[model samples]
Target chain A: MTTRRTRLSPEERRTQLLDLGAHLFATRSVEEISIDVLAEEAGVSRGLLYHYFGNKSDFREAVIRHAVEDLVAQTAPPAEGEPVERLLASLGVYVDYVLANLTLYRSLVRAAAGGTDEVLALYEEGRAALTDRIFREDAQGEILVDTPRTRLVVRGWSAMTEEMVLSWAEDPAGMTREELLGVLALSLPALVELTP
Target chain B: MTTRRTRLSPEERRTQLLDLGAHLFATRSVEEISIDVLAEEAGVSRGLLYHYFGNKSDFREAVIRHAVEDLVAQTAPPAEGEPVERLLASLGVYVDYVLANLTLYRSLVRAAAGGTDEVLALYEEGRAALTDRIFREDAQGEILVDTPRTRLVVRGWSAMTEEMVLSWAEDPAGMTREELLGVLALSLPALVELTP
Candidate 1:
């Protein structure tokens, strides 16, 4: 395996490796993709991949974590807006992000379905971040949910959105953001006391 | 390969094969299983496993259909009662059934996740059943939803249950039927609402 002559900045190298790993992971089954392929694709040596990531499992975890962090950073609710608008915007960002990186999202989901225990925990943690954001702010005093109930509602919403995006990714038609949010707008209130 | 000497009704044999298949399919990855193993475990030859089901893919579809049918039987909302209570009872039934036959449910999910095109179609068809039940009785009272929105919400609810049950199965300590129902209750009014 080719080795780098000089050490790159840790963050830059780690980010590059994660990007390369995520691409490999998304395009094929995790078991089918080897560390060698990942390292070679990134123009880094296998030794460097190992040195930075420890092993294949660790590498996969880092890739998933990086992808999740990107997902969260991109989809966070706006710092200020109409509660409904912010919530809807956040959903739009999330759905768009999934659409943009469909392969990586699928890989992450497949890993959760049948990957290592560590991978599954990471997936769950990824899910919890979405759950937290979905319930983070009140919809401009429209909904009045207690703390415990809010978590449950958030959980339900998080689960629902994950499933919906998966289905839509598998089969997309003319579904638009406005329509999706509109539907969610109607169904969510029925499911939770989001509005006063 | 040993063959049965005595003839049995096709329905009887089919049901038997499905029961055995459910067990086999639920416990292992679909890609990892073999028709030979299923036939051997069912006390028949490989030919018989194919004879009733047509092929391995068909057999898997049969297994999923059977599991879904069982869930439908157990969780179909009662015809009469407070809608909330009926819905809660139905949800409980689903949770209990999943708890009882997690292997079966897991296998069904796996099949849905990784199967032939035909099997995936059947999975989608089976999933629609839950949505059907959701709006079957009092649907007339609700305002008509745009087709895309309706489908999105339906598919959303369908996926949420699988994710929820899988998580609860992993850690049931914090998840309770009542808590889940409470979340649903909070959202029901908005979900099945009649537009003015």
Candidate 2:
């Protein structure tokens, strides 16, 4: 959590509250981030926290959404580089982002694995957004991949990336950063090129 | 559930009870399969069921282990064929096995997603067994993949395969079985070759 000014506009305060909630969530369990805990973290009262984000579920959902946006923006493919370079850069950033928010990343996975229908749906939506953004056009109006086969390929690749990241996160197994990044970045195009 | 003989040895009866439990679990939530329900399903008394399987938790674990064994056995690569042919055949049977036990498969996923330590550890062990098998020697003593990088590749491919099958299971999207099989089978070599 970062220090913030005590006074702000309502919209600014709401944004700050959500960002704070997301930051706290990145390292702590959801159960630990109760309204009282959040308020304490933000140096605000419980009433103020509720006034900003409604109830706890609503607040948690908002924070999750915020965190996803943070991930998407931070790892968005650069608009002005060679396509491979752009992809590699985005992947490096993505791995870093996940490492920074591993607890949140894991909870998203666990939620998808066994959460309620609403939560599972939200998890799918977040994943789809992440996957779709990868194929979005770069500055030259060129797209990396767009077709039913490639869509499936990329979605599958997303799963591969997730699995590799989680496994490597648990134990590096003497894998160097370059090798790990190479596996993630290079394997995508390798799979997509199997278009036929 | 299959028909049983009027008389069975203790070992045969125990095997039958576990198989029946596995069968019921294929389509029903774990919560629904209570001890009474299992006893009634098996045409036995509660005491008999408990005596055979220890307790409800133990019984469920055994059933899950049984299902994983079924998956491994049914999908084990045909002992004799071209490498690619062997993989395609294995993938085909694997997809069928998952379809036949979709509910059980989903629950295993859900358990891995949020189950307690013991369940999660068991889930990891089961997955490792599955993935490690793909790299084991074929009849000629040739392994499909054996290095650390290839091991990672195959494991990542396994995740991709899992995601594609689960998503396709939800809705085929007019994708024929052949196409799905091709994607899952062919993509493994494509990804493994990417290792530099």
Candidate number with greatest lDDT: 2
Clashing pairs in 2: none
Clashes of 1: 14
Instruction: Give per-residue CA lDDT, model 1, range A33-115, as digits (tens).
Output: 56788866667788888888888777767877888888888888888877677777887888888888887787677666656
Error of 2 at A137 (Å): 2.1
| Residue-level lDDT tens digits of model 2 in A85-156 | 787888889888778788988877786666666667777787888777776644342444476666777788
- Model 2 over residues B48-111: C-alpha lDDT tens digits? 8889888878877777777777777788887877777888898899889778888888778787
Interface RMSD of 2: 1.9
Candidate 1 yields a Cα-based lDDT of 0.67
Classify candidate 1 by CAPRI docking class.
acceptable
* Consecutive 10-residue window with the lowest summed lDDT within model 2 chain A: A136-145
Shift of residue B178 alpha carbon in model 1, Å: 6.2
Residue B42 CA displacement from its true place in model 1, Å: 7.5
